[model samples]
Target chain A: MIDHMSALFTLGNMQFLLRGAGMTLLLTMIGCTAGLFGGFLLAYARGSKGTLTAPLRWGATAFVEIFRRIPFLVTLFLVLYTAQMIVPRAPLFWVAVVSICLLCSAYMAEIVRSGMESVPAPQIEAAEVMNFSRWRITWMIVLPQAWKVILPSAVSYMVMFVKDTALASQAGVFELMFAGKALANRGLDPFLVFATVLFAYFVISWPLARFGRWLEAQLARRTHEGDRR
Target chain B: MAHLDISGLEVRYGTVPVLSGIDLAVERGELVGLVGPSGSGKSTLLRALVGLVPPAAGRVVLEGKDVDYASKASLRGLRDHAAIVFQQYNLFQNMSVLDNITVTPVKVRGRPKAEAEAEARALLARVGLAGKERAYPDQLSGGQQQRVAIARALALKPALILLDEVTAALDPELVRDVLDVIKDLAGEGITMLLVSHEMGFIREAAHRVVMMDAGRVVEVGPPSQIFDAPTEERTRAFMSKIIRH
Candidate 1:
């Protein structure tokens, strides 16, 4: 019931979609940066030892578990509605950004915690004998080794986060998916418009995926060379 | 006062005792070698003295002060005065040989990097590892890594050094090179407690040798007396078995 050819390559609709993609890119950047920072703090709290950090450890664990267990769609809707209740004029865009950031941070915390756990106990013990303080050992010895284990998973999460940004369109933000829907509503063929949307996502994610693979390869080669001696 | 002292030292792991009633002393400039059958707690005594193993009972006195192992401040004080080298070398794998040697002095003692690096280079050359400062730990052989670990400990300049079977992990041909370095340290009047299985090296390098069995000291005397004229039945039997091998 529509002309697929005319809808497929229209410049005006393509420009609108590109603008939406730009917003999606901006959201991904802001969300990932904030999420990564929060996740690192959460990871520290979870792994900290001694009686003084006990309450902080418990609170961080509870936060990660609760956020990770809840569905992202439900979290987004809850946050958006809660913000609306507190501030009736709150922008939907900022609401979407905050919700996604909170969700991704929980996942990032687990990724980083596992990486830190993989560092050998003897490495820390050696640092202890050398009279390095607890903080110095964790920051200088533990985290640098952990970062090598954290990077690949972190990049994959970034790709997933970019894809998840499409959900923001549900909150009436004019992101990439929303733009595609707008074009489809103008009597254009729905299949053609969505197929272009799907292709646009591929264009964004493929490079990031490739980059993750390259990083993993580099790490493996480094470890292999270390073993060769 | 003894330079290092352990009296009535007892160590347990979850109700299983590894060391019991261990009393030992080392004077300044003495190299005391600990020889024992496997599971006789020779290494546990070294670990306990270094504050790596918490003692269930007894006191460790260094320079006339008892170390309260349970207190963080006391443990830090003990660590500042003593360092241990493990059987596995335990070098920081993430660092180069130079960084490994210089890290403690620069980071812990707040020494200037230029001074630390210069001293580290001199220590490396002393250990016969000159020109290998930029190499990673894994790039070196077992003997080379152990030598680097010794250099790392020397950079701390602790009052006492504990060598826990430092050459046990090296190849037979490689053992002599590492042993030569420790001999040089001994000749320099460095105070050390060494746990080694090389009977010949023990006879040659140790000023006094302590033989252990079943978590107790069986004999403590000059290496000639312990190896050649043991007073205990267990020491005689252990020596006979070792000689057969």
Candidate 2:
């Protein structure tokens, strides 16, 4: 039984949570930025019509399956603990960052692969006739269209990225969830503190999910209108 | 010299053969139309011509030089001379119409940006899309998009251009606008190989018509002969259906 009252204006607590929220945002932005680039490389390598394509696909698949199967908590524990042994006084924050990036990239790679494949075959043909190199064709043509086509899904992935950052608090990196836990333990009213934390997450993530849905609708409307025209 | 010549061309998708034992030639500045019902290898043949679909067993000679697909350098040399327009307009959808037309010339052809934009603007004007320089593909109509494709192809000043059913996707009313652009392009002396279902355009615009059926050329002659007085039974049957429909 959690009371959803009085925690909003708790000045010291709100500031602490806000600071943690900042760290959470930082973690997601860094992780997703790295994940986007990494995922693209994996997706492109896997999908290319080259001899190395199969091997690269297999390697990426293995990485995804292994990471996705192992519990995130265990993975973080191993990475944080092992990394600390190798280099004491190193930033444990990096371990959390790397873990989130690796997990998100595995999923984002599949999203990007779908985007790449959706580009019409003729588009590449047109590029070839214009004497465009593979690199030029990729950067100048394929990637731009794909970025647009995959945007809604990518935004959803960003939302997932933000939610995933909360898990990093287990690595002792102080973020929103950790901040909430600290506040709850200090106060006698655990339910009030936790309910406020839940509300705070909704405030952050609901907008992202709503924005993604709105974007998807906007794109669909344009496509339907184009067809009608 | 012949602009493009293919001898014993063959293409396959996995174990399924799409084009086999195909032979064709196009002289400089020739306008040739390839017509066939669906799945007649017309598109496959056009793809083969531009090295998009490499032959399983044959040589494509461009200006008397055999296209060696085994060598990247040779293929790059071959690509410089040809441009392709697709059945589905393959405009880079994220870019403005002007960028779609000028990107290859500026980036791939290594022309200065100002020079490429100048040439691209002239091409857009030639295609009657003079004011659509900043419109995105989705903002334009299908006919407009197809014209952008034509302008993009022409921007390269290619020795040979392959148009694969460029108007297949347009509305019936919009079809003529695109074909009219192609007709105007021919008047400018650009060598073009077209695969189209627009029989009227073939009859009026083509200098020569090549009819393909079941992965082979069933007829090759002047459009009048192919359309009005076909000698082959298969050709007559095809024409009869079009006329009846």
Best by TM-score: 1
* Model 1 misplaced regions, further than 4 Å: A170-174, A181-187, A222-229, B14-18, B37-40, B211-221, B224-245
Over B161-189, each residue of candidate 2 has an lDDT whose tens digit, in order, gives 88998898888988988999888878566
Worst 10 residues of 1 chain A by lDDT: A220-229
Interface RMSD (Å), each candidate? 3.0, 4.2
Global Cα lDDT for candidate 2: 0.82
| lDDT agreement with native, every candidate | 0.87, 0.82
Candidate 2 residue spans exceeding 4 A from truth: A1-22, A52-54, A64-70, A81-85, A88-91, A115-121, A169-173, A179-189, A210-229, B187-189
Each candidate's clash count: 0, 0
In the range A1-229, model 1's lDDT, one tens digit per residue, is 2467665577888899999888888888887788888888898888887798999999999989999999888888999999999999889899988898898789899988888877877667778877787788878877877877888989888898889899888888778998999888987788888888898888888898899899988886785233455
